[model samples]
Target chain A: MLAPLLAVLGACSQSDESITEQTKSAVTQTTTVTADGPPRLEDGSVNLGPPPGSMGFWTANNGRLVNDPNNYEAARREMNSRVNIEDAPLQPWTLALTNYRQDTFIASEPYTRCKPAGGPRQIMSPYGFEIVQMPEMERVYILTVSNAMSYRTIYMDGREHPAEILRPTYLGHSIGHWEGDTLVIDTVGFSERSWTNRDGLPTTDKLHLTERLTRSSLNDMDYTFTIDDPGAYTAPWTSGFGVEWNADQEVFEYMCQENNISPAAMVGEGRLSIIVP
Target chain B: MKKQYIQCRLITVTAVLAAFYAPYVLAHHPVSAKFDTTQSVTLTGRVTEVDWANPHTHIFMSVEDKSGAVKNWAIELESPIELEWGGWRPDTLAIGAVITVEGPLARNGTGQIWANSIIKEDGNSVFDLPDNILESQLGSRVEGPAPRWPDGHPRLGSEPGQSGYWSVPSQHSLVESGVSVAMDKHGILANIEDAASVAPFQDWARDLYVIRQQNFMKDDPLFLYCIPPGGPRMFQVPYGVQFLEQPIHQRVTVLMGGGNSNWRLIHLDGREQIGQVTGNDNNPLFFGRGLGRWEGDSFVVDSNGFNESFWFSNGGLPHTSQLHLIERFTRVDLNTLQYEVTIDDPGAYTREWKSAWTLLWVANKDLPDHYCQDNRP
Candidate 1:
């Protein structure tokens, strides 16, 4: 019995050291900010939840998928990006729609109308969010505190996306797995109504996203995603940003549909602002 | 051979580790984390105000301490639903009525106490629970030990290798636990006169309920906005409910398969309830915040903080933010989940009331893919 227990402990110790080294390397490469090392699960996986007595949720102010220096200053202020839109490989029609959406100040955004925030927009809209990993049921829930108080379930137990989704939903179907300390999520089958980005980035029915989430430190989480859609962009593109961990905060109730006056009011200033009257 | 041996050893070690944590997990009762149950206090005072609302009903009392200084103490009790079932009326303790309350004090050191019992100046209990109050059992009791987790706690979710959900409750409408009122599958009363029997509603709430029944619920917010069936209405809906329990996470997710794919979370961990505001600055919710604990085989959930957008239950029952709910989910057998709820909303109902019902566990099937949007008018 002692021998078996020693062997199991040895295996876990090696895995723990590997995760620590990899996390250190990634943090050192990105920024000089020292990490207070995040809490770990029994198996050495970074525990995204509140560590023991402390409680918190992840907060991301900028949900921008791309960094376009030439874009309007207002848009730049809201989005912290890793890749420039010029290198995002946007198609002609998609680029035109994105420009139009930016020009109109995103007034007609469906999310403001209390629609569900789909795809990457789930992580982008930021009041606070929690990644609840329930291994017992082989499910991980990403609960967002804002927008429609939306939540998405990612199947962690080796299950493929359904071959046919009768009705595409706002959240779509997601499957996730662990690569060392990073939680890699692959999602597909999203509704066409919701945008993938707050800047009105459009997505077709063919949108496939591979997102990576890593709790790099107690105070920081690295979120990156690669978008692949034949109907929207010329080629697959990747971009990312860091989400801050908000201590002593939990996901609160946010009823978006209650007395929402945006849909009726957002008329884009009668289109004269764009036509230059 | 070495790989297989390592795999065998790994299972043995995992089992041992799991055993070590089982006792501690089972012994945890963080349910009353909001209040310090150890410290007990008894106070006698005159009622100043009765804030009859959803999440909780706070009875403010003016008590003169030893120094002869009158201080207002907020006495908290079960939600309006539970209080109604306990025979508490909206005017049970009117303004300036002298009463004594005994309960534990709040941990926050505020002048607040979670009332255990209340007595009037006449030495009578304020709660007047009816003798007829009983569990509404259905489909014959299946006598069998319910499935349990390794930690010895009853399992609310599906048993291993089986997929099932709670559906097709015994009672379809929200009638008083003992009152036998006739209503359709949609909670439309066969005789509008029976509206008085459904629940002890305030004059205005009963009037609104009658108007809704008269118009055949054409103005139902659930139908108009595709809103979630909040409160006890989640069970009254068509497709039933599913329990996703994550003991490690110290929470349970109750998913409603009937109305717009809605779900509510109940935290089993001992965390103090806090204020909630949406990013858009909206307060209050349809499901409200829930804190739960396991009392033997029964899982008791205390929920509060509801908004008035949707009905508390079917038949157009109204509620306010002051609505408080105490719901009990007990898995009596492999195929039965007993659900009991106490509604204490002084804003809508004249007294606190309760409704008890049981839901059958539909085995070897998933929740039907039903959404209000798909069948909305």
Candidate 2:
């Protein structure tokens, strides 16, 4: 694992200075990036994981800090794992819907149908995505690894979103502004055609997502997001998800229709946290 | 060996991957079942109605048969979205126009043809699709708008990425330069040469392709429903397409204005392929699970894992799970986007094949609302 991470760091031409400063012997502690965050490049932008021209490999980290099935197993090893939020504060409606998905074992996910898992769900998609930041045009793109080959464009040009008369799409309209070293994003206007995750966390058109992406270290960009939708939850809920930089990896093409023969033998049941006793 | 083996994995391995497979709902159906490609007919009739819906554009006409009887014919054309891009307006072929068209006859004996080409009485070709037999730069050029954006890409009116809408070449054949052929702003069948072959097909695959083509592509899943044209097929639509680069995210999006009003995202960020990870279920896909990178000015996309549900080419070429595609789109000039694709499917074809064509930038227009309607009663 260290070898691959090292190779990626070396491959990135604009690797943050703090990456090389990562303590080499702290192998037991998964917390790699120090709190100081990454060093800025000559251009003043924090050296986030991979520069625009580079690739990012992320596997050790899941899309969300919460509800990562991979984290369910991670909890057994790391007592303080993030997935311990199996009993987090979710709106009654959101929790009921999610519980229904697991209880009935209905395997309907946005990914299963090859659709964009719209809204903040995109950040959590296991298919992975690449961030292209072009301050010149005042826009950012999050390209995902789905067959629809869809992407979300976050306007950075200080323009207001279109009026409500506009059409809703899989990816609601988005725009961003920078807060010092962090890039703050505000997104709206979703089609609600997708679920938030395999856990069936639902969303609606009223969903307003505010995301703050700050590079916590050379290889780690601490992603803090807040979901504010009066329709889905009683109050705004916040979560922290971490994305590590893997320089050696490149995003691959994904087609949902081909070889999509999901065998019952392969698709085992999910790990539901509800108590039976 | 087999696309990293997720499609053929066992339970323990599947668990590690966290991706599973189930009986997927067939989103699109077969068109060949309704239309017979082996059979074709010509119909010249007076336009009665037009259903400019998504998935397909339908033309209703009353044709006079040899026996002097009038038959109400339903002619199928490509999507209206594609038509709009090819310089077509809603009023281009208004009702009461006398139209001559030819294509495969419907298998159910309905008086219809999945119209391959439609010619108006004024000697104007109204629809020409599935073109691009041979390439000649000098022979085909559709100029874009008056001004280019500051970034060197074509600007379609106010849009930076769109210089203009693309126009289909008038003639699929080499004719005298002075001679003008009627052209309806339609798509072309650019893949006709040996290099465009889906050959080296296994016996069953070969038969499938033959049967599909002979049936006039009626059985194509696209004909049944206007699903997103995945992979290379998305780029090959007759109405042409545009590429927008969003620098903030290091991403490129292929906005396909053809009929679907759909778009494909190309990730410039170098993220690892999902399938390459161990115990990871590299999800099988419709559009090749895709990735994009820039090599010089050309943007190259590498994709694979196509479901056998759809055809990748206009000719209903057959492919299996092993199909791999490398597509290159180079804005060679303001007016031309040089499009090329290399197809490799050992399971379906005998060898790898390559095809190339040029997309003429249509100026002054962005894509209009083109939606494929579901289940017309």
Query: Poorest 10 consecutive residues of model 1 chain B by lDDT?
Result: B5-14
DockQ of 1: 0.04
Highest DockQ scorer? 2
What is the per-residue lDDT of model 2 for residues A122-156, given as tens digits with 9 covering 90 to 100? 66544456665544444565666543445566777
True contacts kept of each: 0.08, 0.06
- Quality class of the docking in candidate 1, CAPRI style: incorrect
Model 1 — TM-score against the truth? 0.67
Error of 1 at B79 (Å): 34
lDDT, model 1: 0.67
lDDT of 2 by residue, B82-145 (tens): 5544556556787777777766665566566666568887888885532331121123345544
Chain A only: give the TM-score of model 2.
Answer: 0.70
Separate DockQ for every predicted complex: 0.04, 0.06
Quote each prediction's TM-score: 0.67, 0.55
